[model samples]
Target: MKTEAQFENADVNMARRSFLHYAGAGMAALSVLSAASCKKDHSKPQMTTGIDIGATGDLAILNYAYALEQLEAAFYINVAAHMYTGASDDEIALLTDIRDHEVAHREFFKAALGTHAIQALTPNFSSINFSSRASVLGAAKAFEDTGVSAYNGAGYLLKSADYLLLAGKIVSVEARHASYIRDLISPSSFADSTVIDSNGMDKPQSIAQVLAIANGYLTTKVSAINYGYKAY
Candidate 1:
């Protein structure tokens, strides 16, 4: 019953599974590294006032990303603090993990931007009823989806290869979060036409478009002064 072809197929399948497992572990390790490296940077001067996350440069893009991460981290932190009623244990664990990932992402951008990073923003979650699962999950879906699209749209604006690579790594994680949240809201809607286009690509949003949606939940205004930079 053990044919050579069957054995080869089994080996190939095992290899694929192993590769996926290792890749997931690698991303997890990266997240830990990002968070652990967020030590006190006493040497770098902090901005007392919030700066416009704009200008034609990589820093502007990084700050844009940082702003989004701050919003997401704050949202998840609040969700974790006030767990919605009727939330299952699995839901709690997933939300906690998402919160950790967002914190790591926020820290990574802050560390990378150093003194240039914008001030910590105050979120206006007045519209979100955190006590209700529908409200919480709906907000989660919107944030995750918006984040993934923001990164995708902004990736072309990055001139530095390093920044692009870092963005790529983070965007993939965001997309995964979006997919998971989408499925949670409605099973089997993870990769539906709503997010994925006819060309089989995730939809992208301009900075203005994203900020318009994000500002509804943020008390502090985020502006992109001069983001029309030529790609390097």
Candidate 2:
């Protein structure tokens, strides 16, 4: 049988391989977005106290996703910097992989958005107790769940089929992250009925709903006013 340390190393290796595969796919997809964007207006959104994700069609949705990715990335970066007490080697490896993935997702959106990308927002993790395992995993579960829902809800708002395709790809990854985090919280609870409905589908949340929950963790609020979404 493989030793615990061997398992940890294996998991970390797998995660790095996955990240490389994802990065290659992401770059290909971004190239498509770049070429497609050239034909359209590439104006930047107006800046305000809080980040305005713009009222424009696809760009608005992209910025919206970017904002959420930024929050998740920051949260995990903090978690990895100081892991909770008593965290096992397996947990550390898994969480580190998650952090790398979230960071990749964040940069992907930023690059895809290019000039239209929203500025990076400061994260507010004051409510989280990173020193406790329960607190850290609980917060991770919430972020992953919210991210999956946000992508599902906003996919339809994208005007370009290419953009929608990209969103679909990203959301699928987010769902995997959600499942992993959920299982970490409670074994075999990854697809609980609370998030998975009677129809056996993952739940989706509106941009307004997502931002309302997300902004609480962000020092800089985000708005998709053009989509008529005002964070509550």
Candidate 3:
């Protein structure tokens, strides 16, 4: 016959063994789950060769703008570093201001996007001769005109009222830049019939149209397909 104390000891030992068994099983299950999760993560697709700006959402629009700003900022930075010869004092001052504005716009978008901002793009200005006044101003005019048209076309796509307001402000400034550059290229051509319609409305281009022109000057090809915008 077993003593009472011995019986109690046997019960305690069985209980301890059972607890350890369940604990070990739980740990093994957790390990299996962790492994499965990691495998799923690894199997996910990565960003492809071209820059995918992403589809659907306010973020996509923001990223689109961010990419353009990056391009403009890079161009202005390069031009400011080595200004064209025979540039007037007024031209230099205007270009400097434009550079600062573009830099500020780039930084603003980056800060707003935080972790979602696209990578800095590499601009191909090989076609532009920075030493020549005509080439430099011509390039600037193209960029500003494109920027304004881009904003105008994309403004309706924004979901947030605040974002629309902010875009309006920026586009107005872009228009100013475009006007200044246009006047520099040809006297009194700022609001000419070429850029504005007979009704006096600024012309707008779709994302595809804008990106097609922009890609010619950018090493990184921007793809708006992910954002549901048609590819050029």
- By lDDT, the best candidate is 2
Model 3 Cα lDDT, one tens digit per residue, 1-232: 4443453354334434444332333334333433454455333334555786766456678778888988887787767768899988998788877876776677666656656568878789999999999999899999999999999999999876667777888899999999999999998999998789888999998898998889889988888876666545
- What's the lDDT for all of these models? 0.77, 0.80, 0.76
Poorest lDDT segment (10 consecutive residues) of candidate 1: 42-51
* lDDT assessment of candidate 1: 0.77
Candidate numbers, best TM-score first, in rank order: 2, 3, 1
Clashes of 1: 0
Q: Any runs in candidate 3 off by more than 4 Å, and if so which?
A: 1-48
For every model shown, the clashing-pair count is 0, 0, 1
TM-score of 3: 0.79
* TM agreement with the true structure for every prediction: 0.77, 0.82, 0.79
Q: Which stretches of candidate 2 lie over 4 Å from their true place?
A: 1-49
Compared with the true structure, what per-residue lDDT tens digits does model 2 show for residues 1-232? 4543454355445545555455555446656765676687756645454778876667778888989988987888778778899999998888878877777777777766778788989889999998999999899999999999898888878766767776788889889989988888889999999899899998999999999999899888887765577765
lDDT of 3: 0.76
Q: Compared with the true structure, what per-residue lDDT tens digits does model 1 show for residues 1-232?
A: 4443453344335434444343344334444434544553434333322346755367678889999999998898788778899999999998878876787777666655666678998889999999999999999999999999999999998866666777899899999999989899999999999888999999998887888788888888676645542211
Give the clashing pairs for model 3: 55-226
